[model samples]
Target: MQTSKSTTRIISISFFTLALLGCQSAYYGALEKVGIHKRDVMVSRVESANETQLEAKQQFQTALQKFKSVRQFNGGNLENIYETLNDEYETSAALADKINSRINDIESVSDALFEEWEKELSEYTSESLKQKSAQQLTKTKSQYRRLIRAMKNAETSMKPVLNVFKDQVLFLKHNLNAQAIASLKGELNNIESNVATLIKQMNKSIDEANQFIKTMSQ
Candidate 1:
């Protein structure tokens, strides 16, 4: 009877040990499944982030292209207009300088950002990227707007100066007497002074606008 009792106790202990091991195995399996699920979620998030970056990059490219096209058109028109005007007014030189300055400013920003953007785009594969590409794009567009404004102001200021020069030249051409010629020369000098002042103001405005654009781009 003692032998029977001892054998029964052994059997009960073995069954309890097996049951405990089964519970541990099930717990570990459940933990592994949870870990795999978390990994999948993380991977999905990373993919989404990459997609967002790509989309932002495309938008930036489009904006930049548009800016370039408009800039070229404005620059060409300005050149043609300046070339048609008489050189005596001294307006073309100042206008050309302003236009060139603006073109340089625009090119500097677009070229630098374009290179940086290409580099950043290649490395962007996650959603929590360090680079804020969209903000950069918006800033670039704002810079372009400032450049356009500066060009327009320069053009507008030049018109009045050209008109005054034209009127004075026409007057001198018609009134050829010595006294009339002397008086017309004096009048032309005064018109020239006014033109100089306008050019100075236009330069200041262009400088301020360019500086503002540079600040925004940075």
Candidate 2:
């Protein structure tokens, strides 16, 4: 009975592996039909990630500006300030989510591309060509690791800033009065520092991404 079960499992595994390979072959074929390769997809994903970081930076800056503007609220529609703060919080949260998704997409394509590159290196007939390709693969992989580390570091830096923003937004939401405004004023300096740090990390990540893209293109 155990032998039969093992045989059944082996067959199932073989079928699944064949199906996966067939699907991947079809996917690559379609991509080639449109002049898109895995390398192109990876580059595009990196660019998309950079763009998302840029957008996120802008959104955070806008939120900070709005927060500062609210500090000067001596009178008039407090509701407007609340609405703006809430909007900023929601928008920033959404941008963070998008940035994270872009990072994941980049990672997915990167793993597939690197795996394919490694596998193809073994298929090269000429020793010289294989050696060269292997060196290039090693270098590319090293560069990619650095680039991804920078990107992930930047992504990690954003969390604390976002948390602070959320807390302030929630506090203000619950206490929409002069006291709340006064309390927020106390947090301004810390928020500014966190935002600055976040922006620096983002800029570093962007530079790393651009460098990686240029290297890959070469």
Candidate 3:
């Protein structure tokens, strides 16, 4: 009886979570009915993506700091250090995935908005208004093109830093000896350089997102 009750509770929680998520699309659709369309969603998503990049930049900085701190280890159990580094890698990878997901979301909304705009253009009675709408669409699409390219470049930049972190963490995990520590020290400079590059790219991408959001809002 207790086991059945626990299973039922878990299932209830899962269903509640799913229901909350389902409400998000419904909320957006509801907004559209009142004329708040996908363009607004795109602007909001770009802002969100910018914030995520800022957070991810800080995370990589923390990971770099942790990597540098490994040099101070004199003679103690290295398990904690390994665990911390692994955790950083995991967190960074998750953040990267978030950035990618945000990019996809922006693309999805942009596609929907563009398609709807094109269809509406065909239904327009005034040729002048249709031309104006087409021009606006082209301008918006150009801005989006620039924004997405910047974001993709930033996303591409994350992989090298992540790879370095993963390599060092896995090395330490298997060896867990003085030699492994020395090996990490040798890779520290390279890691620092990669993290610096990543920070620069993330900042540039954040700037692009900000610019895009501001323009879209206007």
lDDT of 1 by residue, 1-218 (tens): 25798899999999998897577446445755777332233233323333332332233233223322322332223333222322343444344444545444444434444555556656767645635665665665575466456545654555665565566445545553454345544554455555555555455555645455345434
The 10-residue segment with the lowest total lDDT in model 3: 20-29
Q: Using TM-score, rank the candidates from best to worst.
A: 2, 3, 1
> Model 2 segments beyond 4 Å from truth?
1-26
21-140: candidate 3 lDDT, tens digit per residue: 567557778999998878888888898889899999999999899999989989788888889999999999999999999998888778777887888999989999999989998998
Model 3 sits at a Cα RMSD from the real structure of: 7.1
lDDT of each: 0.47, 0.88, 0.89
lDDT over C-alpha atoms for residue 30 of model 3: 95
60-120: candidate 2 lDDT, tens digit per residue: 9999898888667778877788888889989999999999999888887887789889999
Report the backbone clash tally of model 2.
0
Error of 3 at 64 (Å): 0.7
lDDT of 1 at 62: 36
* Candidate 1 TM-score over all chains jointly: 0.39
Best by lDDT: 3
TM-score of each: 0.39, 0.86, 0.83
* Model 1 ranges off by over 4 Å: 1-87, 90-123, 128-131, 178-197, 209-218
